[model samples]
Target chain A: MNFINSDKIRKDFPILQRQVNGKPLIYFDNGATSQKPQQVIDVINRYYQHENSNIHRGIHTLSQEATNAYEKARTTVLQFINAKHNHEVIFTSGTTGSINLVASSFGKKHIHAGDEIIISTMEHHSNIVPWQMLCEEKKAILKVIPINDKGELLIDEFKKLLSPKTKLVAVTHVSNTLGTINPVKEIIKLAKTAGAFVLIDGAQAVPHTKVNVQELDCDFYAFSAHKMFGPTGVGILYGKEAILNELPPYQGGGDMIKTVTFEKTTYNELPHKFEAGTPNIVGGLGLAAAIDYMNNIGIANIEAYEHELLSYATEKIKKIEGVRIIGEAANKASVLSFLVDGTHPSDIGMIIDKLGIAIRTGHHCTEPLMNRFDIPGTARASFAFYNTKEEIDTFILALERALKMLL
Target chain B: MNSIKETQQEIVEEFALFDEWMDKYEHIIELGKDLPLIDKNYKTDENLIKGCQSKVWLHAELKASKIIFTADSDAIITKGIVGLVIRVFSNHTPQEIIDADLFFIDQIGLQEHLSPTRSNGLLSMLKQIRMYAIAFSTKADA
Candidate 1:
């Protein structure tokens, strides 16, 4: 018996009611992006319809209202993540933007030639590339912490890689491809012992679990709103106030600057320093609505229900012949990634798409992880709180149908 | 041998027999199995079309002014579509290959495979085919 009433919860999402290819849409691609609930959608629609205005500059009533709403959204995020201060939350494009902001700004201030930045093998391309670019520019060394066949990070190897020269440790809290929940609190503690700043990529983590930056004591945490049933093009970057103030601004534009001269310009304070331009005001509002929706259900309940779904799906998939489940970590989220023997993932994906089952089948932006597994990619079906056991059954039937056609 | 347009028409007609998407896919999977295998040597990175989802390798050669195209994909469905593409363009002159419009894919309900977002490199493979045609045509002119 699940605590979450997913059938009642399903009504909030209109996309769930729609059909695809003459079949009911079974959205298993939540790992790619989650479908927005009507509440979040309504907030966005209402904002654009009535309160559309550029934030923080104009003295107009609409501007003030939008500005207050956007700032309130920041506070909502701060409370949601249990951050220390509202100024610590900076709005960026998405998780990629947030990570890049740290890589660029933090790298500019602290990173020097021969300084080491550590990341793991399971990092998404967004997490890997920005650091790579930073390393290349600063002549810094980027060391990768390897994972085992089960996709769990080898902590012993991580300790070996850390030294006095280590400047920062960046890793995903939950891997997008493998769905492995990394021991980030332990990772952060270890990094602190090495005198390194820790930045956790919470893009995959925040949607499924409760994240407390204060409890974890990480220097930076990044996540996207779209993955959590909010609008796209908006994300939050929570940094320690002291470090964010010390680091240079990522981008230079209107809101980020205090005053400008031809030769000299003074940057704004924390939050505004990182957020350079007129931000995604409506996206921020939608994020607040999404956070409200989550709070209404309770994150603990969402976690428990999703875990049950993951377990149920995992057990059924295990019984399938010639199917290999990747990332068999002891701790995982609601992500099921697998490959059927003697069949390509894309062929399976194409066949199942016709059945109106949307699952992601590719490298999933973690090409290096695919290389580590010595496979091209895996077909992934990630579940959310709204996904029911019956939907999982339908997905299993679809998978079996796909396998029969391919094999 | 049928002209490229005639071959496309024949493919469209054959696909028209299947009303169900599953039947169409089954036919494609069967065609994929029957596709003439590209030489293993040509499966190198240089010949590989960079698709985000799947890998496709293509090799073309000219014999007596007629281009012969041999292609392969790790995915069976992509291979099947590639076989259809090869059927239309293979044994045709470079100019004819260059001039041919690929309407058969859309007609057969396989247009999604050719979408840029699909990332199977079918669209890229089609572009590569034309590039091969242009390269060979230039060689003939020179």
Candidate 2:
């Protein structure tokens, strides 16, 4: 595989130099939360030191400066997702909070007792629980589309699940557990025909791939900044203006107010309506800087490089005795999940960790999917553009040793 | 019940001696064994944690002005690990649970063994435990 600006990229992340268990850290948990680059960290530091204040109000100098940076971060997100307007971009705590906002706001208004909300079998609990709670509250039905044994969504099954009663279709763009990239655009198209709004959980897709909400025609898209090499407690929820306008506010507090009275409190317009309380100011600037970093490296290049890494890693991992790669879909993102014979995933992870090759083990926030597969969980080694082939070799060797030790 | 500071100090002392990763891990599993799993009859849907790789059962017991947590899992090692957590942090008042500053979790070298999802589960367990403690303490205070 062609090496990325990997050495240059490596220098930008100080945490990469960190040693865990007497070895240099090889963080494979990017799919969960990527380590931030120096650029993002520096941006955060610069913001706090130079421009720190509550945004959207105040005649003070820091307030205006903070407001500009925060709104600029929204614009950056708009450009990143190719959303039509900055107003559609809402800052949230993270992807889960964003999804919950939609479930609470949109689901509360748009759904009725008999209406159905369709999701796939391979959804994160964040996507599932919020909707389940909403469905339970509204007496609406929750429909799950089945995935193939290879972890690809059965489009036919999804189509069958669609009906006039289907109010919303929420699906993950990529499986955080299995690396399955669902045909989200097509799903959006089908759901649209059924008069259903679509929300794409891009938490797993945004860091590795390019997403255009307008081009994809998804009504709503949610992603976490931390997973894309930015700070924690920051995320983006991009919604079409029409849908966002139709939904109610998620939380009522400081910034979300347009005006307030004893009898009635008017909420703010799009974006601000959902962002209540003091938003993460430094985190916003950090996210903008992270977007800039991605712009330089190029998402297409990263996706291509990671595709090659996954194939290469998958090939070597498959050669190991009694190793089974999970989620073998025709189309997948960079993450690879697998299990070793006669060894628990936790056990395999423990040994591999000693070799300084970090990997995620267990259900990956999709226990229902795990139950579908009839396995507890798998050991997952997800690759980002910052990863190299040598890391893959180290990982394979660790797996071999772990297998021997466990056997 | 002991003051929150005293319990935290005790927890720190219990873990302060461990130097090796594997040794620390063994201690954690043993704590999981200490997890005072609630009664099987209590294993209703409410006690069940959704999205677990295995059947994990949990409940809390109030012991001498403190909340003691008992948990069990069908998965052997996971159950053992749960026991370890219970030994370290369970049976404390809400103030104590919150104040105990489980930050030692990272220093003791336990977070590395956990998967992100499993870590999520652990956080959920901790949250539930803390929430339980808060409820109990709120009642006691009220």
Give the TM-score of each candidate: 0.99, 0.79
RMSD of 2: 7.2
DockQ of predictions, in order shown: 0.96, 0.16
* Candidate 1: tens digits of C-alpha lDDT, residues B1-142: 9999999999999999999999999999999998776998888898999798998999999999999998999999999999999889999999999888879999988888888889998999999999999999999999
Candidate 2 per-residue lDDT over residues A1-407, each given as its tens digit: 45477898889889888897798878887787888888888888887778778888789998998898888888988899999988999999889988999998997788899999999899999999999999999999999999889999999989999999999999999999989988898999999999999999999999999898999999989999999998999898889998899888999999899889999999998788988999988888888999999888988888999999899999998888888888999999999999877667876676667768788887888989989999889889998888888888888877786666445
**Candidate 1: DockQ?**
0.96
- Candidate 2 residue-wise lDDT at B95: 77
Model 1 residue A171 CA deviation in Å? 0.1
Error of 1 at A238 (Å): 0.3
Across all candidates, the chain A TM-score values are 0.99, 0.98
Report the error of model 1 at residue A350, Å.
0.6
lDDT of 1 by residue, A218-325 (tens): 999999999999999999999999999899988999899999999999999988998888888889999999999999999999999999999999999999999999
lDDT of 1 at A360: 96
What count of clashes does model 2 give?
A: 14
Identify the candidate with maximal TM-score: 1
